[model samples]
Target: MFVMGHNQLPPHLKKFRRLVYISPVITILSLSLLVWTYSSDMTFQFITRYYHATSDPQTPVQFTLPLHRGPGQMGPEEQKLSLMAVNGTKTVLVAAYQEHRTGQKEVRIIAVVLRSETVAYRCLLRCQEQLRISEGVSTTHSDHFGFAYGTADIMCPLPLGCETASHVTVISAASDSNDTQIQEFLEVKNQKVQSDSFPYNFVVCLSTMFDFTNVLQLVQSLEMLQLLGVNRVVIYKTSNSPETQRILDYYIYKGFVEVIPWSLSKFVNVSRGWLPEHGPGDLHYLGQIPALNDCLYRYMYQSRYVALQDMDELILPQSVNSWLELVPLLEMKYGEDKCYMFENNVFPNTVSLPPPTSQTLPPPSCCPGWENVSGVNILAHLYQEPIITETHYTNFKIIVNPRAVFSTSVHGLLSSLIDCSWVDRNIARMYHTRASRQTELTEDELIYDGRLLSYSTKLIPNVNAVFRESGLLPEGSIQ
Candidate 1:
């Protein structure tokens, strides 16, 4: 096998093979060296620039952090914000004695913070005089969605005629303070008893309503409100059925109801209950707390008194004919600035209606085909259930002077600058008509409360008229 082979190849051929291997290695090393040199030079330049920037006093240095981590963060655009003016002047007019005092008005600013450092507010009041005020922001509460409810108070002094000032420019404070432009303009109107007063004396502020399909009950409720002397009713609507919308439009045209478009579903996942433990809404009950607060401010100066209640509930006076009569009597007994609380009385909707006797009045119907509607028949539910002692039976609702109440909750006002009085249940009570919370309550447990019977005659015709006008019923449906 030992014969002349490639091992004994010519010297020229062997030299070519060695050169091929060595050439590639040399190329790789040269490229690597060039890259290292370039990187080193860039690093040196960056260090030198940074050093000079820090060392020189004239050179401006800028630092940045994540917006959420930063001191003053600009929050999401969808965050709800509002401001309202309260008449700071107090005038006491007694029959025999009179006292008058004039003071600077106060501005209440509310900001719903989703994600921002709304730490302070800069308010500019431009009227007879240009006044600027700065106030620190404070969070009253927060919901499961991490929406921080914040408020700020600003004192505003205006010249005599400037009482009708419409707007105040407001801006959130920033870390890089360079006099940020006004982000929002808050409405400011004199709520005092000037030459012209608000047309409506009482307004019912309903909490946030979501996916409301109760058309029949809604109409009935509206009719009851009219009978109760409610001049206006404001509902914060998140969503509703087509039927409900049509009914609302009818009331809106009649100037009896105002619907505030609530578009919270577009931004966050809305939950049905107060806590997300049950479901997936961030703010409690479709941002109900905020809506209630907003309603208070929205009608603060427009209505003399505001009743915070649900659509299923009605605060009825046992002796008086209407709230118009009840409010005056209440004020005389409890004073003007006091918040009147009414005892809650539950009337279960599951209970069967009383048998139609000669004295019994026939319950009004919504329409022929609408007998099996989605909502409960409020008229059929007149059986008052015995109050459960362990539960918060004594839970109450409030009718407040919007100017005097500072903050509000579901049951009542959290704090009021004025006094609060609990009206006796025998005098006036809240008729809450809804599904029974308890699983069992016999006929013996239910008692007859005929307070609602008085409003039936008027309520039936009003509901029929509203349905007819809205085209929900025939044109001659009232007859």
Candidate 2:
């Protein structure tokens, strides 16, 4: 009832009208600001919880989310991830990322595996920070094989007694609302048994054997390893002949050998030599470094010592017959934690013992099909290439305490938790049998060292039995 005209308003009335109009606008803005601040703080708190829950300060951090985002939307920090089945029940998720400049930045690794019916089980993998040269004594002087590699273990959540799982999707959490699918669900089978369950004293690790044609030599080498007291031989096989496969099967059945399918060809072109620059593969020495590291870890808790060597090489003890005796002697001279390196002594096949003059030679077709094998005949090759005093011997192999070795190369350990020294060739040395440097070397060039003669009595019969058992040789074939 007391409404005033627009032009004839009292001062008090005008002031009150202005106050009423301004108060509502100010109140609305203040309320809006308060709500926004509260929401922002809540969001920040949520993100912080996620970051701390899954990250480590000393190692790389992992982030996990429930949903996946497009690859285009991923931040620069997010790495390209992949999953490889190390064995049947265990799959190793591998990721390569930019090395943190500050060393303080966290790397978050969130892995999720899908069970049947789209049910997902989340896993937090702690990255085993790679061995850095600055951190400890690194024998690996070259960076030819350097890569920022990180691994996470995915224990398959399949039901009891199930060795494989199908249609598994692995997801990683990210900063964006969308989760990243690192790997699509594919068929995953358990290939490796628990390493802790392996009952072996001295395990021999042969890395990345490609295009294995030397069947006879392989069998002889295995037999010699057994003779030398090697309880188990693990070979990362790429491919081999049918004959070799049969031999491997025999050993596997006998529980003396383990063949890890080297599927590196599926990932990248594998080089045959350590110098990738001179070879075709991406990794040095047919990815030998990784395979050696894997073997070391696989046998760390299982075997007392693991010998890293080629299929054609044997670390023969000069005085002792079995490695069981040689190891204790070596450990006595060198501390137990030390990695023992053996000097390489190459013996070429061309300088073999003159065809047994005393005994009549059997017909060419009389022996098993494997008699015409591609590899060096260890029995025939008893003469070694004489050592040149001036030459710097670079080629050597190692027998290391699995727990002490952190990383390894074809020749020796790259990094060890303890000291490493060259084992005196007088006590033990590596006998490498291969094609002779020259077609014919004189008696002066060849040093007659018949170390293998001692094992021939047993090696010949054992190899013959395997050939017969595998149907490669007849029961009454050459005895």
Candidate 3:
């Protein structure tokens, strides 16, 4: 070995050479190690948004390490911990860290749950190495599985069904408390949805058909819809039938229904496609039938569900007595994004008449039992001077998701996006009282009537000419 004294060393360069080579290597090595450790152990999280399908409420995201004890082997002095969420589904990602009881060296493990698109439920745990020194011999230890437990439970949407599994892709990390990589597990690539549509709890639009003329039955049906938790009702009257007007007014007075005047004839001019034109004498059908479509178009834009029908038709109850009871069952069985379809059954003679046209009235205590009497009650009662028979009865009705309804017609139309199911038959019916006292009309009344003017106009073009020539609107009221 050769030894040199400080005096023999090169005074100008020795110190600089030593400093440049050693210090730079040390600094570079320390930085490289720090970068590797940070890249390995650092984790991230993000905040996301969700919406309620049926209601307008939005849930807030709360983050914290849960207080539950983790499952697995643990040291006598060490306490294990895990995380959980409540109210809504939660996503959790965990990283492990260890510290020596002596020198206090630190080690960390980074983890990520790879699956989380819009909504998800899952947990991730990362294993970390622990270091311990005994008798001057250094020993390193690593856990096979991270020292944590507890899992995420994901909440799925309505009409949920199993599908083919796809690989979970981890996305960019969110720098929050979740400490997991956010990813999209489910994707709707080309979902086509209608825009600018009205959403309502339920919508029922009434169209008057000159059948049975049961004003009382109409009021009861309106009340029943209100009791069923329907928030709004639109009565589309084509004919200015005094009795029908009275029934609508009764509901309006009670703050239950809204009456909007519409003529079927003007509808024909404004609506061209899917509407068939009527000729001279057949104009009655235009006012009575096509009025459904016209009124629905005006009112259904803001409703979530819609039912269109004549005054005689009513939605009866089967599984549940009222709509209030049925909504929850529906939410549980079909989820928030579902539609219900009701089949038509005719219940004749549920109405009792010479009924007043307008007024608020209660539906019968029980569904009418047409056990024995038949032969069209309206005709039987009106034919006799005493009017012995009753005419108050329910006919038929259809239930549907208003949002899923596409076109309005006499029968109506529902879109295919909805999951359709049948309602119990005994609960509701469509009573056809057309063959009774309603079939007859005086030529003058048909020609000069203002009551049926709107329906006549929508269904019958130039109906104003007939009414005007007949001296109905007098020239002053005519446009």
Candidate 4:
């Protein structure tokens, strides 16, 4: 009866039955279209929530809230600030800011990408118009030391030259449609939005410290840096021992060490050495150059000078007591707008000065309980490898006016208008304490340098105090 009803039904009833059958299919199609529409609007909605309405011909930023991304659409801005790959390309974006240098007049994203292009990218600015300008998206790659994974400045020039942007998002335009995928906007930094005096005089950058367990030396180094007039120490550390973490946390509480997360190996196949022969990886020195460059720009306007050095070394003033006394002399001798290169005078661990006979004599090198700490004591090693005539003035580390330098490298400037000069070793030299580079040299052949001993009177107690603060050494350890 039910099967026969459709053919035997009255004319009016038959039409109504057919309408009911087709309506459910129509409803399903409508819901699918609604979901697609909402998905496309997520980025636009995420943006419009923060930026206020503006119709100015200049079309600068109207306003900006705390820079955050929409949920479930993409991954969270991870707790670790590692390199972010741009939409599945080799191009990994580290940061972005308005370009005031080189007069390029664009927004430059500091990134890790192939030296040559594999894909096209563009700027998706959070402007009044919600602008998408893909025409001027060019690539400026800094192939520092001919390393395989060079740092690229993915350039996005503004059409109306708006430098007042509070933030901007970058996207890959190589897709079938430019609007398919989007990356979160990094709040524009180094903006120079307002002119003011720098907060610090000297800032040091120690990059790519991996698996560090040098606790005693790290404490001694920071104490020495403080004595030498460094206002800030930026450490881009990959990982460290649990003991070392206590020291870093203490220093951070003391407002000295800034530990930037550096997990480049997690993102790229980072090479262990600087040369090409050290391959089976993508970047050099476990991504050292990018970390250095990031530090430079990060502190470009915050500090008057930035010194790039390793954790195990310090650039000490030979004649003067501290860098406050030394830098003025350097400026007077070399003139301003100069990249001051100090010769790396290696203080070999293999050669040590004779121990003091008295607690107060031969310099105050006695510090109790630090002996139990799991790291080298930088003070004990005083003798240095004799400077080689062939390599004289060749092996160097730099302290430069961050604004004067255009591109920075491991040893020195890759490109800069600033001239390079060697400070006389008597004036200042890098006290590099590490495994001996000249393994052939005997004890007598090395020079006896006691410059570090000069700081021992202060360094001894300072080391003990840090141990106390970090809970690294037990009580009754401080004298």
Q: Find the candidate with the highest lDDT and give its number.
A: 4
Tens digits of lDDT, candidate 2, 144-167: 453222122233232333323223
Task: Find the number of clashing residue pairs for candidate 3.
Answer: 36
Candidates sorted by TM-score, best first: 4, 1, 2, 3
Best by TM-score: 4
Off by over 4 Å in 3: 1-200, 208-213, 266-284, 287-291, 294-301, 331-337, 350-396, 412-416, 426-479
Model 2 deviation from the true structure expressed as Cα RMSD, one decimal place: 26.5
User: Per-residue CA lDDT of candidate 3, range 8-83, in tens?
Assistant: 6585656765767777456657766665554321312111122224334332112222222333222122212222
Per-candidate TM vs. native?
0.68, 0.61, 0.35, 0.78
Q: Give the TM-score of candidate 3.
A: 0.35
| Candidate 1 segments whose C-alpha is farther than 4 A from its true place | 1-106, 114-135, 139-172, 175-179, 182-184, 189-197, 265-269, 355-373, 392-395, 476-479
Off by over 4 Å in 2: 1-198, 355-374, 389-392, 437-443
Give the per-residue lDDT of model 4 (tens digit) for 1-479. 01232367688867876778777456656766665566535745544554434344333322122222332111112124536666746777787667686665677677777665567776766555365454425444455456667776677776675645566656676644545344566666777832347898889999687888988888899999999989999987777777777677667655688878787777778877777686667787888887888888788888888999998889989989998899888999998746899999888765557744443347444777877888788878887888888667665888888887666778887767788888888899999988998888888788777788888888887777677656677767756
Query: Which should have the higher lDDT, number 2 or number 4?
Result: 4
**Candidate 2: residue 319 Cα off by (Å):** 0.9
Report, for all candidates in order, the number of backbone clashes: 2, 25, 36, 0
